[model samples]
Target: MSLLETLEMLSYLVTIVGLPLAILTFVWEQRKERRNEEEEIFQRLSDEYREFLKLVLDNADLHLLRREGAQTELTDEQKERRLAIFGILISLFERAYLLVYEDEMDKQTRRMWQSWEDYMREWVRRADFRDALPGLLEGEDEEFTHYISQLMNEEQKVP
Candidate 1:
């Protein structure tokens, strides 16, 4: 073929192949970046949960970690502190539900969300936490209120 014709054919080949390849690569990179962002958010929330657990451990006298609650009646001051801790926990759970939970999640998103669900389930299993939930849920996100309430009901049914 003539030089000009050969050059024209190369351009056509790029238009047919390289253009679509570039578009696919761009889409793939965007998806990867989104997944990375989701992972980062999940990690930050996980760290916050760890910090909250430390708080719980620090107040071991309150027996907040116990499934049945404190063995004896708490002093007025301890009751106040325990209520405050429960408030903090409910706030964290609300944030996690708002940020992570979704009605239509991909497999990876669902997997990340499951850990948070388990945490909620564990806390809800505690009788004290369940008792405090209604007061703590006041003025929180509506969807989160509904979600956790459902979880509380489900946990209550478990033996």
Candidate 2:
């Protein structure tokens, strides 16, 4: 073939192969970046939950970790503190629900969300937490309120 014809054929080959390859690579990288961002968000939320647990541990006198709740009646000041802690926990759960939960999630997203769901289930299992939930959920995200309410109901049904 003439030099110009050879050059034209090379351009055609590139158009047929390189263009689609480039598009595929771009899409793959974008997906990978999105996954990384999601992982980072999940990690940050996990850290916040750890901090909240530390707060719970610090107030062990309140017996917030107990499934049945405090053995003794809480003094007024302790009641106030316990309510405040419950409020903080509700806020964290709302944030997680807003950020992580979705109506239609991919496998990776669902896996990450399962952890938050388990946390909510654990808290809802606590009688004191269930009792405080209505007050703590006031003015929170509507979807989160609905979601946690469902969890509370489901947990209540279990023996």
Candidate 3:
């Protein structure tokens, strides 16, 4: 073929093949970046939750754990503290549940949250927690309440 004819064929081949491959690569890179951003957000959320729990454990309010099921009545102060602690916890976990419920979360993020599940179950099983939960959840989202109820039921059956 003449030089002009050969050049024309090469241009056509590049347009047909190279353009699509370049477009595919660009799309793949964008998806990967988006996935990385999502994973980072999940990691930060999980880390913040861990840190918050650590702070809670460091507080003296943990005496409530022992008093939770006791016949002794908690003072208004103690009950307020309990509500505050659990309120923080529920909000964090509810954020997680909503994210997962909507399928915006991936398994790796779910696995990261599994560490908190035991603590969550333990607290939800507390008598005071259950007693106060209905009132606390009254203003909350229905889906989150259902999710917490499901977690509670599932945990109760696990032992």
TM-score of 3: 0.75
Compute the lDDT for candidate 3.
0.72
TM-score of each: 0.94, 0.95, 0.75
lDDT of 1 at 51: 99
| Candidate 3 lDDT by residue in tens digits, 1-159 | 999999999999999999999999999999899778767766777787777767666755546446355465667877777688777777777776655445354676566556556656777777677777777776778888987787777766765
For each candidate, the alpha-carbon lDDT, in order, equals 0.94, 0.94, 0.72
lDDT of 1 by residue, 1-159 (tens): 999999999999999999999999999999999999999999999999999999999999999888788999999999999999999999999999988899999999999999999999999999888988999999999999999999999999989
Candidate 3 least-lDDT 10 residues: 61-70
What overall lDDT, based on C-alpha atoms, would model 1 receive against the true structure? 0.94
Sliding window of 10 residues with minimal summed lDDT for model 2: 126-135
TM-score of 1: 0.94
Return the number of clashes found in candidate 2: 0
Ranking by TM-score: 2, 1, 3
- The alpha-carbon root-mean-square deviation between model 3 and the true structure, to one decimal in Å, is 3.2
